[model samples]
Target: MIEKELPLFPLNLVAYPGEELNLHIFEPRYRQLITECVNNNTTFGVPSYVLSKIEYGTEVRIVKLEKTYDDGRMDVRTVGMGIFKVLDFVSPWPGKLYAGGTVEMIKADHDGDVVLQEELFKLANDLFEWLGMEGLVKFDQKMLTYAIAHKIGLSKEQEYELLKTTSEKKRQEFLINYLKLTIPIVKQMEQAKDRIRQNGHFKHLDALDF
Candidate 1:
């Protein structure tokens, strides 16, 4: 396992590998962190929030950084694709929120058969259509996968489960299962909405039968 000390950023949200996270760095410390990353060409770790503790986060590379203010604030967009295991942490100050930790990178093996990826994309597309989001068909397969995964309603724990897997084949399988469960729920919700509309309960009526 490749290990190194990394800066930890705990967010209220969970970001999966191959997902995009846009952050507004306004705090002085984080702004400093961002500046150091941009200047040094380094990446940072983002641990998933779990039951009041953050143990896993994806290592993200900064794709674009835009200066939004003269006071060291930035509008930065990053893509997360690397998983890291937290080894140790230190919170030097009590009130300070950020902490530093040692991390080991978890490299994923993408050597799986391409046929599996193709089939997964097909299933994902079908799920999107079933959810009445056929408009997403225009997006590239990778983007479509990411979009659907975001909509799967996985909790932070479930997302961390996906993040920790090192095999592409297993990740695809998990995602297929998630799509199976989520697509039906979305369809049921849509059916309920259709029922409510067909009943005309929300429409203005000319008169009511007495």
Candidate 2:
């Protein structure tokens, strides 16, 4: 396990591996942390929210940083790709939402299989059309994968399960199953809506004559 002390950013949402996160640094302490990461060749960890603080998070690398103000406020975008276990943490001194934690990096298989990639792309395209989100499809493999995964409505825990799996083949299989289950439900809902619209009444209501 590769262990390192990393600054933690607690968010209301969970970020899965191979996902992108955008943050605006405004607080003084987070501003300090951002400055440190920018100055040094360093990455930060984001743990899944467990109660108050996150005990498991993803390691995020800074991709872009924009200086917005003379006094240190900035806009930044980071790509989260690695899963890490949080060992310890310190509370924000006061008026800060972020925390710092000791973490151990978890290695994952980066060798994605081409076959699985192609299959996932196909399923993603099918899902996009099924959900009537065809215009949103980017056709880029990575973006498509993430967008479909999110659109299929995986829970935070389920997303964590996907991130922790070290096999690309396994991840691809999991995504396929998820889409299979969710797509039917979405289609059923659409059908029910159509029925309601045709009858001019809620689906649960008995048909009545005017």
Kindly give the number of clashing pairs for every candidate. Answer: 1, 4
lDDT of 2 by residue, 1-210 (tens): 888877787665666666778898888878877777889968877777744556777889888895568877899888887788788877762344457767888877656667878877776777778778886757566543444566566887777677667676677788888877877887888888877788855357677899
What is candidate 2's CA lDDT for residue 130?
71
The residue pairs found clashing in candidate 1 are 46-57
TM-score of each: 0.79, 0.77
lDDT of 2 at 29: 76
**What lDDT score is found at residue 48 in candidate 1?**
79
In candidate 2 the C-alpha lDDT for residue 186 amounts to 78
TM-score (C-alpha, index-matched) for candidate 2: 0.77
Assess candidate 2 and give its lDDT. Answer: 0.73
lDDT of 1 at 84: 81
CA deviation > 4 Å runs, candidate 1: 93-98, 113-119, 137-148, 200-210
Question: What's the lDDT for all of these models?
Answer: 0.73, 0.73
